[model samples]
Target: MSTEEKNPIIKIYMLGRFALEYDGEIILEDEGKIHKVWSLLGYLLANHSRKLGSQELPELLCADERSGDPAKVVKNLAYRLRCLLSDSGLPKETYIVQSGGSYSWNERLNYTIDTDEFLASYKRARQGGIDEQTAIDCYLQAISIYQGKFLPHAVYDQWAAHSTTYYHRLFTDSIISLYRLLEKKETYELMLPVCEKAIGIDAYDEDIYRIYIHCLTKMGRHKEALLSYETITNRLYDEMGVNPSGELRSLYREIMKTLKSVETDLIIIKEDLNEGGQAECCYFCEYQIFKDIYRFIARRVNRTGESIFIMLCTLTDKEDEIPSKKYLAEAMESLKVSIGKTLRKGDLFSRYSHSQFVVMLPDISYENGYMVGKRIQAAYKKNKVSKVVTMHYKLQPLDPKHF
Candidate 1:
């Protein structure tokens, strides 16, 4: 409640390397043993000007710490940061404000924030036009401005949602732009590295894998492309206990056929390339469709490190006895007929678990993934099942070499 601490000089502080001011002239830097809690404050402030309550601040700061009361640590850190800011001649009523149970920054303070400029420029560039080079330039600039992931050292905080979202947008946009440019130029070699980097940042992104697959095919690396299917297949099986989407499976088959040119020998030569096969568990019965799917993945994904695909499902509260064998059999028939009409010949679908199923497609990207999911959902809807069954789908692209 003291006037001295009422409105401490506010400065735009970036939470990277060490807490450093982006715009303050009389640079107030902390080099000696910087408390994790102090870093946590910088993490919260970096998000936006918000009233972080006293009760909430400590919890946010100490969320990852196992051995201390977050409340006490947060209070001490705030007091410590306040002294440092004041001693460094930070503007009065600028840096931070302490209210009853909260702490907030004065948003009106004048300061040159790299983050602000980066975001503004990025927004402007993207709004320019599709396939605009200016947008590409601004996106690179934004990537540079991102010192590190928002609050890299700050274990955890509830306010990190915004920063995470913005970071991903910038990253995804950059990758997609590069993909388009590379595709136009036919620079397969150059496109490979960029797509790799994007996948490293977000492995679950299907677009990255799709781009990789396309680039590989164009570059005449058909065998490698098929091998990649195995890697991604294993990953999805491990992480989500599911497989790639149906579009990808179709792509895989198409690529294989393209790789093996037809000969006039009148003899069908199957290239020993890895692939999913139809199961004979049920002859003439469509209920074996789900079984065929898992068997397909099991045959193909015989390696490791690609375990990020997951299948999550929730059953309707009422009439919940995981679909019986007969019901599943009926659903399989419906799915086979539905998918047969909607999907290409080679698409693969597997049972992820009791309530969920996965459709795997090797080279298909977002466009096909969306189409596949929508059609399948529609099929489930149009068919009159005995119970209220709902399925939600998520698609992930896996690292090809990981397997």
Candidate 2:
């Protein structure tokens, strides 16, 4: 047999990192050197079926540089890439073919790229008409092959950037599809690790989190599901400055419904509710819980004729502009402590936005509510928070008729 026939098929990985493997040996680019050789080679290989014009190749490879001789630069890089392949112990043959003024990858090379297999598997899985198990197998294969975004090292390159987005979308779609199949099969345990892996690759994908949480709940791991929900929600707020979608919020309600066990004894329920110990300050809850509390209070006001007020505390710069993230975070923390200390335990508060908090004060007059807001500002200053952050407050009476 010829050397090429006897050797293992060369494998090229282009997902998380660029690499070439042959006969148990792996090749990677040198860290300190410019990657023109690898860049030229990767582009050619990615478009192997068609030839790239010699003039176009230089511009594509060195678009940012003002090369004195673009043709010579392309020639030198191609030579270096050929040497790289030769030194890697493959059969000595031309990998880049030049015809007239255009270059193309050798069609006869025996090699496989991860992206090719990934795309094929993804297409097969989504084409439908296949059996459930077969479709699932295809999806799992594609998911396993997709370690990360395509050409991560060349993300800034226009071509690589477009391909990166395309592949990432495919990977996320496969994950969602896999979840549906697994869910239909009622294989919650099998999906836990898959969802975890998917989340690691793309943390901001709410659909993956929803599927993960659903699987966890199905396995009766209510605490884990709740923890995941809290984690994603906090990350979304802190990083993206947005709230969870209504679908995610609805899923949270489902988790809460399943989290509690059936209990007839009021004493046990009371103990469960008081497990966190005596309240040392005002009640702090999620925005959803705050909404529920506000609604209940609005209803109760009609019967008890008690006064209720809502206060909005906003953090801004001296010019009344929103503060920077660092300042806003520190000021928000300090403000939380201040509100907890100044307000009565019966009062409720929640973070209303990236730079604001909402407080509900029951059984208090409008004047008292305003005073409470001033007390919070005073406490915030006493804590020696940054002077750049300014606190602004607005109060409105809670009217039952508006409920």
Candidate 3:
């Protein structure tokens, strides 16, 4: 403790990145090789509150390296770290303490860690009985410090899981607490970004979706709420093709119910595009909903003894030249209309990708499925949106497990 008094505090950041600052001066981070130094600092920071046994520290640090004495290697690393600290003008003894057969970051040193501050701020914010302003301030403080996960570099390391999970939960809790307080005052505009942030952090949390939907509803943005629900369903499906939960479905139903009152105006349209009564045919839905419907139909085929098949129609260029994006999008929309006219009323379909339309035809045998596919192809060919682009299709029987 002889020196380091001029700049007494060590500012170490551990929330998102591993950083060390003293007297507003950064260590050898901007220049060169300090990976081993970084690893040593991370381990000590991870187990900062208490000392790790000398043997255990070395073994943990050198878990992957074999053929050498871990203790000797760790001793050399420790000495190197001490020298680094000394060269940086910090009292080396105050930074790393070695005694009683253990090693730890010296508790007596004046240092601030982002992870520790995040926890403390969240704790202070949630200690009271939901004061909105104070809760907002505290949660913001915690969130401001959380640049990213506990240690982005060591994300897969087994040692990082516990703290990562803890910080993740704390972040979610902060959002919940702030929401609970904001809900009382009906401050949805303020809560909107918060919900979006939390969802960006953990999209798997359905409760946050509920709050987000509620916010949208309160703000009279019902369509965006539905879009958010679809966003969740789509993400869940993409990551793991799962259905929307009961809560989410119920929320969607409630929103639809709110929008249900049919307009009773003197209904006479000047454009009159629906002269053929809504152009008849398959039910169209979003890709995620279409996937769920496919699975639902698959589950019943075995018991009901009905044949169901799915088809994908994609747009391909007739020649070597690639079509522009505008033409591709125009072609997809035109193909959707053609398919809708060709398929039966009971069938289901969706736009599966940028230029692909997927259709599910139920209670149809292989022959009939082929007939339906041909009908769609013929219809699309008849009204060719692009002169050089054409429709290509693949059909297969219902495979429940595949869905």
Candidate 4:
């Protein structure tokens, strides 16, 4: 359309998947009868936010063609599409108007795309902050509007590619935002599946890995969580030729300590268990217990890699959970003797969950990882099932190249 055209009117154009108006009107320009005309119009309307030259219009419409008078064909199709737009209630100033050799859609057409509405809602939600439930509601509403790939079946056109890129970004940002919001509340169980879906689309994205790590940690899947860190490390190293970010490196080390503590606690529980009562630790209970420990570590770790040496001990028996404070104190005292000497001055010790004792170590390293392992080993030696407590270790190198 002509950029110089004045007094243009706004006409909403919906072209994706069953073109229907916001007011419930359907606009179906027989694709079978006017393929060339529709293609040119779709191209122009898709680029409605920008201006295009008349010469460029034909080339866009006849992109796959070898040798034909694309210029003349574009001119004729533009004329027909313009007429169609007018007949279809588009004001004279609304549809495409002729410029020099080029054409431009009427900028005055106050048409709104579904995606625009989605973006508006998403932004509002993000800026609303943590206490704003409405923001999360709006963000989710926007996400739901993304029913399918943007402008599906538009073929290999450049305009379609642009739509694809835009939608991909929107989806990714929405996922990241949603994850961040939910993370503050430690809603890992709720957000895990959503994070996985986003990872399925863009596995290279670091945010997805971070979300996964958070979820795994809260769920007390320490070993599995460590594997995720390793995966990210390997991916960053092998592909980006870089090391994990400082935050991630620190998180990895923290998970290592948590893993060790969890193993020791499991051993204590198993030794105390009469039989198969160990499996009574359901995912829900385990998740709750782990979340408490994670929150404790997350607070102490704050912004340093120093918080990786945290550990938690939890009772595996579900039925015999209730006990006196004195009994608990004795257990805590025994745990202190077993692991306390190995801890530093600022290391945190707390009774986090119903049957869990969490220990936070602010600073730890690869060279000392083995030492911590040995110290934990000694603590477990007094336990009945010390030998069965498998000592699993996965060390992450600090070098950027190793990720």
Candidate 5:
């Protein structure tokens, strides 16, 4: 089959990143430079229905240079852009045209633009007949096309930013509609994946979570449904400083009821009730909480005469340099486990950084505090993945009452 016959007339991709393909082959360009040629072409094609004023392109592209006339630069760039497109096995004027103090795509070429096609499919699906299944299929197609923000690499372009916001709203709306229709049909098998993808795209949407919870409940996956609800609420708490809605709380109460009745295994129920927190080490919380506790202890030590010691443990390579991020992360996790095993039941420890651990040994003498730090170092070293991973420590002993 011929190239033109076998492929899209011209394919323009602006999702995630930006690229163009005429027929089936990717159009090649400069080895490294970000050229204005293709970006302008994409803008024209994306806004194909509207005419862009001459000044708009210059302001979007060449606003920073401010050396000469931006309009002249736009004019020159337009000619170069036409030639560049023409070199891509297309006619000189097949895709771009200039008219009446404005520029736009020729609109004559048989072409498919990702954003346009997505929007068109979305509109038709919403306006189509009352067939829920067909609407869902169209929504899936649109969602799949939107891999990321519109023209993600071209952040400076105001038009691209505006288009991105518009498409994101459409994408979420489609998910909201599609999930409702699927839930109405009771297609839990297919609806689960749809809910997951929708969550992956927009984790904060309570509407998506509502349908997701319903699907999970239908499939008897109440545990996973509760976990997902907790995940979203934690995200909201940490990221948005908000709580889950009353509707979500009601759904969760029902899940709890189901779990209580469904789990007939007394052993499992017993484990869930009794298997929380360890006495080997004290509570771990946010770094700020750790610091606050330390300050409170510092204040009491003056009156209590309690020998308080703080230890800082850091991971280092055998060569005394910081390890790679992967190694660092693994070493830290291992160190955390080892610290938990080595600390006494009442001792407190918190991870202070990716490579640092802070521990409080209260009521211990200076020598015992030093020994505790050594014990942590020994435990951390035992779990090292390689000889390159090692531990270094600093211990501070404070007895404010005697000072």
Candidate 6:
């Protein structure tokens, strides 16, 4: 048997986590130790195809420390890395080679890198004239290989950051291409899991969520699609302090439209409408729903000649400065509850910003609106809310002509 057959190739995983697999045994870096050892190893492996000068390694690896002799530190790190490889049962001499004051990963070593294979598979998948199944198989392989960002441990490193971005873009593109191909084949169910996995990898990616929701809707799972949309939108708002994109919002509307089935029984429709039970106070809805209510009320004001006032409640520090995120979030929740309990049942309210709430009051005079705002502030203070958080309100008349 050849030498290659006698020993299995060393497998290095830089995605999600950095690990080494040799002869079916996993090797991990020692935590809380000198990070340069592993950092050097990762850097060399990342640029394995090219030779890196010893002088350059010192600057990159020891950029923060100015007290030591950088070249000497790098040399010692190299020696320590080789010892680590040998201790891990890898042929140390066959892995990292030094010549002319430079180091390079041994090209002839029996080794495989997950990233190299990932890129290679992706390139093959994109080649012209390949059969659809072959392309799909390549894409699936590539996706499976990319567990997460490239070398997450070295994410802050400039080189690693660039590679991470490139690989992630490629991975997302692969998912999109795979789903489009599945759509062509009329096998949307198969696309569901792929899109779902992609979302788990990058939850903030709206495009992946859009595709996943589309697949769910395509399979007649409108409820699941709607739930997914709600879950993502809530998460986005809570974490990023922003709403979903227009595309995702439009998708949500489409899902809601699909969920509406023609029901002959008026009783069933009424029950569905009152599923949340009678409102004890103001109607609290999502911002989008609140906007819809605003428009409807604006149109009605022209005919009924009823006055409507919109109040914006803002939370700030004692000095009128925006508080910290944690404090602001807590104060906002308290403000929401206070407004809900203080406003009338016909009133509408929604969160307008990270530290603001917009409330709608109909059939109320301007003076009454100001009084209502004060009532909300009093309720909020009576609940023993943070003293650092102070409430401020401004009232504006909702003009029907603007609608």
- Could you tell me every candidate's TM-score relative to the true structure? 0.48, 0.89, 0.67, 0.44, 0.62, 0.90
Q: Over all chains combined, what TM-score does candidate 5 have?
A: 0.62
> Which residue pairs does candidate 2 place in steric collision?
none
Candidate 3's residue-wise lDDT over 204-297, tens digit each? 7788898899889878888898899888876664444356677888888777667434554545343332445664657888766687777777
Where is model 2 more than 4 Å wrong at Cα? Answer: 1-4, 29-35, 83-93, 317-319, 323-331, 378-389
Candidate 4 lowest-lDDT run of ten: 279-288
- Residue-level lDDT for 55 in candidate 2: 72
lDDT of 4 at 24: 49
Displacement of residue 402 (Cα, Å) in model 5 is 40
**Candidate 1 vs 5: which has more lDDT:** 5
CA RMSD of all predictions: 15.8, 3.0, 9.0, 17.4, 8.9, 2.7
Segments of candidate 6 deviating more than 4 angstroms? 1-3, 29-33, 89-93, 276-278, 317-323, 381-389
Q: How far is candidate 4 from the true structure (C-alpha RMSD, Å)?
A: 17.4
lDDT of 2 by residue, 67-180 (tens): 898888888888888888888777677878888778888877777889988999999998858899999999999999998887666777787788889899998899888888
Predicted structure with the largest TM-score when compared to the true one? 6
Clashes in model 6: which pairs?
A: none
After superposing candidate 1 on the true structure, give the runs of residues whose Cα lies further than 4 Å from its correct spot.
Answer: 1-36, 47-75, 82-118, 129-131, 143-149, 153-156, 261-403
Q: Residue-wise lDDT of candidate 5 within 149-190, one digit each (tens)?
A: 677656566667788788888887877777777778777777
Q: Report how far residue 189 has shifted in candidate 2, in Å.
A: 2.0
The lDDT per prediction is: 0.57, 0.84, 0.75, 0.59, 0.73, 0.84
For residues 53-103, what per-residue lDDT tens digits would candidate 4 score against the true structure?
Answer: 755776677777764688877777777877777677544444676777878
Candidate 5: where is the Cα deviation over 4 Å?
1-8, 28-35, 89-93, 199-210, 226-255, 260-268, 271-403
Task: Give the Å shift of residue 32 in candidate 4.
Answer: 16
